[model samples]
Target chain A: MEGLSQGEVIYIIVLGSLGMFLFIAGFAVFISMYQKRMLQEQEKRRIIELDYQQQMIQSQIDSQETERKRIAADLHDSIGSLLWAAKLNIAYLGRLSNFNGEMKDSYLETMKILDQSIDSVKRISWELTPEAFHNTGLSSSIMELCSRLNGKGQVIVFKEKGNQLFWKDDRALMAFRIVQELLNNAVKHAKANSILVNLNWNSNRLLIEVQDDGIGFTLNDKIRNGVGWWNIMHRSKMIDAAIEVKQNHQQGSAIELTVPLSS
Target chain B: MNKLKVYIADDHTFVRKGMIRLLNTFDRIGEVKEAANGNELIALVKKTIPDLVVLDLEMPEKNGFDTSKHLIDHYPEVGILILTMHTEEVFILNLIELGVHGFLNKSAEPEEVERALYAVADNDFYRNEIVNHALRSGVRRSTEASSAKLSPRELEILLLICKELTPHEVSTRLQISEKTFFNHRSNILGKIGARGNVGLVKYAYQNHLLELSA
Candidate 1:
């Protein structure tokens, strides 16, 4: 070994170094493959977690719809009939008191108004409870309500811009309730003169957009802390849609609802 | 004197008919007409120019607000009264701006309506006490506008402005002079950090200055 030529020794050392480098490169490749495998497992677990969350949301929605239908039916069928009977009794009271002077007329008038208020509350209750909601599909129902409301202040423009708005029935129902509640907020809170609503199917998603030229507001405002905003947000979760609420550049607030048609 | 012509606008037929009966019981109310919805009421108001219009808040075609506003704009001489079951301050606040001359809950005693008819017909403001209480309660919850130094009178005035009222009309409602009303409006704008009329209206709306009824 000591008698070996200098060139031969140098060649040996270079070859040995190249071999060590190849071994390290091979080990790095193996480690990279191991890391990729671990990432794939984590992703699979994450997907499972997401699926569980979706199922839980769906269960909650199903329960909520069932509850709404039940409560609405109770109010419409049970309480409504009772109110009607009471109203009829008031009319009957008119028959007993005929050609009355101011005092008797006053008595009869009080009775009649008492009956009218009962009726008004029942109607509002029905609208809130459920029966009125189901009789009409969400779009037509909302349009009817807003159309009725438009007569109140400035014209509230309500229109659906898309062709295929049919969604998973639960999602549709929840979406309908959400829009109804938001419209209530607009009318009651925004002091909005004109409310413009847009609903449509965008690409593969069902989109609901509510914009108002009235007083626009940020979503995180304290007024949104109650059941109204909570309901809208929970419903958005049901359809896997992300709601982008921002002030419209012109003057108002625009709520953009984008829900995927497919899971 | 001739009877003051009266027309009724309410969604419920029973209520409208009841109102018609109540008004006719008095010799002061004459040629009582009835409309079941806002559209009918508007058409009737335009056609007849009734001395007094009694409208309900929740009606189809045109609601009480629109119908009343239309009547006020087109027939300023005719007194408009809002007879509603809800006496929420917010509703009254909104009505006040619409220049609604009289406010009464449907739950009011029959005499209240007759009194309201007389006062409104006489071109006087009748602020239902229940409504004031509701407004006071609603204001208590939203204090965002409290620090702005808006006097109670200014708040009442601010509410009317929100309904898109002209300053002249605001003067008539509050019994203030045109000059004072202008000065107050400017002061209100300055205090609230609002630029123009819209800005004032927007700030009032956002700060829950408008007594909003459910």
Candidate 2:
């Protein structure tokens, strides 16, 4: 080392420094590249898990809907028919002569009771699966729902703007269910007095705004983790819709849903 | 004043039997025949046309809607009445447009059924509260822009029907025979491209033809 020339020594030092610098830079790049690959793998797995969850939820909803439809049909077709037959037979008996006043009164009372039961059956079947939802599209079905829900102190008003668009049955059903859920929550939980459901049709999307005057919800953990909230979120996700929850200024809550119609 | 022959069709044998028994009690209804479904009803109608054909909407083989359409196209003179558990306004409106004579809820009292039968038999159409409310509130499906316009008489008939007046009452008030009134009604339905009473009411409401009393 003492016999080495100064130029050679400086050159050796510079070469060593250059090699060290390159090694550090290479190490940094390799570490970063490895992290990038790990992140990509993690993201892929997350997406797969999300898709599997979505599929599971979808099938569950489908089966539930099918069950609801079947039950509604059974109630309407079987029980309702039997009740009608019984009512007719009772009516025929009433038409026959030689009944005492007491017997006549009892017959009338029985007929009245039968009538009430028939009404209850009709109401139950309708609630399970609205026949209007299948016959008419979402708009009229919602209108009918609003009318049905309007009379008992709580007033629900449905308004539409712009031209109505035709939606696929499944998608329309989801949207209807979401709206129904919102309305139910408003009536049952929020105890809203007056609710307004406005549907705005845009070129590529339908915007639904449900505003109510009731006890508004706080974004607390209870509400955030609620089953109703969970259902609304998952349903909106299934339809590829965007939902916004807004706490109203004075009272009540407002939910806005934007449903894309392109699909 | 001949006995009004009726044909009743239902999938449930008990319901059909009960209905027939109740109908038998009515002085107006006679020679009541029964069918298990819409197809059987159609075959029965082919054998001998009845004054009125009572239909249950949901049935095996052929449904009420198709059967009604066939009857409307083939036997225009036969009065069709729908008696089903389905009391939805949409169903009522659709059946009316298909030219059904009347619509009755399955839960309706025997007396109401008798009245509906007599109404259909007498006036060719029944205007119950259900039909009226449905017509007044329902939104019409946007049909093609019809260039055909309603004449003065047809417009008058449309307004009267929208006012909840029955066909018999409207004809009597207008000093026309029931046949002439029905012809005008069919013509009005055709001119406006309306389905039936529903279309007429919707058109009347949309065009501000009827004065809605609060």
Candidate 3:
């Protein structure tokens, strides 16, 4: 050591300092990379959690729909048959003509009431889950709905202008449900005298417009009234569709949904 | 008055009771036998062949499909009238293929039931408007499938059945023995893949043997 020159010592010190600087820089890069990996893992976990939540929501909705369908079928098959049989029995008695004047009058009146009851049962079951919707597809189901509403003194008009559109069963069901909700809101809240529905399909997309000429709710009112809005928004998101509800006191309420199609 | 014996096959007891009461009121209806399910009805029917059988499709033990098949295969003489709650066109069409004498909704008036009973007893097909509409639509949907060709004799028998002629009437009209007429009807039913006379009519409709416009 004593024999080493001063210049050699200076060179050794410089080399050592350079090595130390390089090690520190490498260590910093390693730490940064590790932190970045952890952030990515956390992001992935959050996405998976959101996906699980969406699946849960979808299953809940599916189970509810299944229950509604089962109940509707039960009502139609069991109670509906019984009512029909009762109606027939009464009709038979009325034919016998053995009843006196007052008795015959009561019998006729009973027949009328039974008829109404049967119709009511049919309507309730249909509203729960329409078998017609499944059998005939969306357009005819909607037409049937409008006709029933019209029969009951509500003027609901349906218009379709374009090529006939076909949709998968589940998608059609969801769309039908959305329309039903909108019409219900119009009937219950807007107190609308008339409702207009338009369904149009073009080359790449389908558009649905439902406009009511009744008391309308503004954007603020919609935000405040959260009962059915949440359902509509959730369903819209589920189908990868967009919905816009516009309303004002003077202009009435209007809702439009735009859906993209693969075909 | 032709006193006709009728058998009722339904899962619901109330429906059975109501039908029995209505049948009792009809002067032409003699005995109204009640069975809870198709199996019970089959057993009772084997013992005593009723002039007509009223069946509901969704019965327990044996459904309307199997029951109708059994009846047609064993006792083809008994007329079958289906009274069901289902408004499905497919179900009605399938039953027609089973060769039911008539198809009526459970909601039909007692008068309709009486009419159907008399119609079947008279060896004629009895279908209300609902059944007709359903079958007409079925024909339109299934016009693509062709049926086996019928001989002139078989075609004559089919037309007579469509006219609601009984086997005896058909035999008398053609001056053939009842047994021979039965053999012809069976052969035709097999050739056309029909379960009974109702299926024969449906076949006639599908092959344009019967005019849809008419």
Candidate 4:
């Protein structure tokens, strides 16, 4: 300390301060870079989880559809056939000449019950999985659905315009299911008296508009958390369709789905 | 008239037995045979061709579609009556195109079944309300050519055919001989490029020649 000059001391001090400032700056850069890397890894994991969730939902829906088809086939093939056979046997018994008036009346009543059972089975089977969907495509199936639902209190009017194009079976089924859910919601939840389902087919896309004359609903937590709505949302996502919900001013609500046609 | 030989094909034993029993009650039906599936039905048919074959659509060995096709191609004279649970228009239309003589729902009353069987046996084609409704709504227009080359009389016959009227009825209604009706029918088929009655009904609907009514 006694041998050092003033200029040398000043130089050493300046050099030491410069080295300190460089060390602090380098440390700051390293900390920021580490945080950025951690954040990127977290984001990647989140995306993977989301993809897994989507796959799970998709499989769930597919399994449900398979189950429904199986049940429908069983109902149609087994129960329906059995009921028809019973009705025939009853009819055969009625043709016999040994029956008294009371027995004949009982036979008639039995026949009527059998007929109603047969009808109920047909309706239930049809509702479970529309067999027409496989043979006639989406339009005819939707028309049939509308007609089936029309006379039972609520009047569902289905209007289709433009040339109908062919669709992939799975995608078409999804669309059909979505429309079915919407109609169900309108009837059961919204208590709609009249509903209009318009399918406007364009060259590249299909625009579906479902409007109902019922109590309108808000996009609240209850609806968002509902299984039906959740299913609709997930199905729309699967089909890559854009969905828009609009509440009418006076009454009811309208849902518009824009579905891209690949074929 | 000779008694009609009938064949019943169904996977369910009860259904087949019930159907046989019901047919037995009818004095017109004779030699009622039974088969478990479409293949069995075909083999039985090969031995002795029945006047009418009642087929269930869903079967184990072969489906009704293939069986009916084979029968229509091989034994064109044998009447193919589809007596299944399917009441879809598409099924009806497809079977009709395949030249099935009749369509009857499994839930149809035994009387209706008898009527369908007799109709198919006598007239060669049985037209029920289901078939009529399917013809009206299921057939779609194929071409933009609105001009169907047909005389007014041919058009009238075509409409009657679409209305589920048999050849005899159409002839009687139009005050024409059966021979004249056949000639007109042939002319209509040629003009519209149709193969059979199903084709004629389809053409009538496609050309908007037949009005859509209940």
Task: Output the number of the lDDT-best candidate.
Answer: 4
Candidate 2, residues A1-263, lDDT tens digits: the string is 36889998999999999999999999999999999999999999999999899999999888878898999999988999899899989999888765778997899899999899898888878777886776678887777778877877799989999888755377887888889888888888777899999999899999999999988766663375487777788889888999998665448889999998766
- The CA lDDT of each predicted structure is 0.68, 0.83, 0.79, 0.84
Model 4: DockQ score:
0.61
Interface RMSD of each: 8.3, 1.2, 2.7, 1.1
Residue B2 in candidate 4 has what lDDT? 93
Backbone clash tally (model 2):
1
Ranking by lDDT: 4, 2, 3, 1
Reference-based TM-score, model 3: 0.77
Candidate 3, backbone clash total: 0
Query: Could you report the DockQ of all the candidates, in the order they appear?
Result: 0.02, 0.59, 0.29, 0.61
Best by TM-score: 4
Ten contiguous residues minimizing lDDT sum, candidate 4 chain B: B137-146
Number of the top DockQ candidate: 4
Give candidate 3's error at residue B107 in angstroms: 2.7
- Chain B only: TM-score of model 3: 0.81
Candidate 4 lDDT, B131-184, residue by residue in tens: 778876565623454466788898888888877777889999999999999999
Q: Residue A95 CA error for candidate 2 (Å)? A: 2.1
- TM-score of the first chain in candidate 1 relative to the native first chain: 0.68
Clashes of 4: 0
lDDT tens readout by residue for model 1, A93-141: 5544664688677766766665665656555654554343433355655
Candidate 2 — which residues are off by over 4 angstroms? A1-35, A97-105, A159-169, A198-207, A211-226, A248-252, A258-263, B137-146, B149-214
Q: Can you write out model 4's per-residue Cα lDDT over A20-52, one digit (the tens) per residue?
A: 999999999999999999999999999999999
Error of 3 at A3 (Å): 19
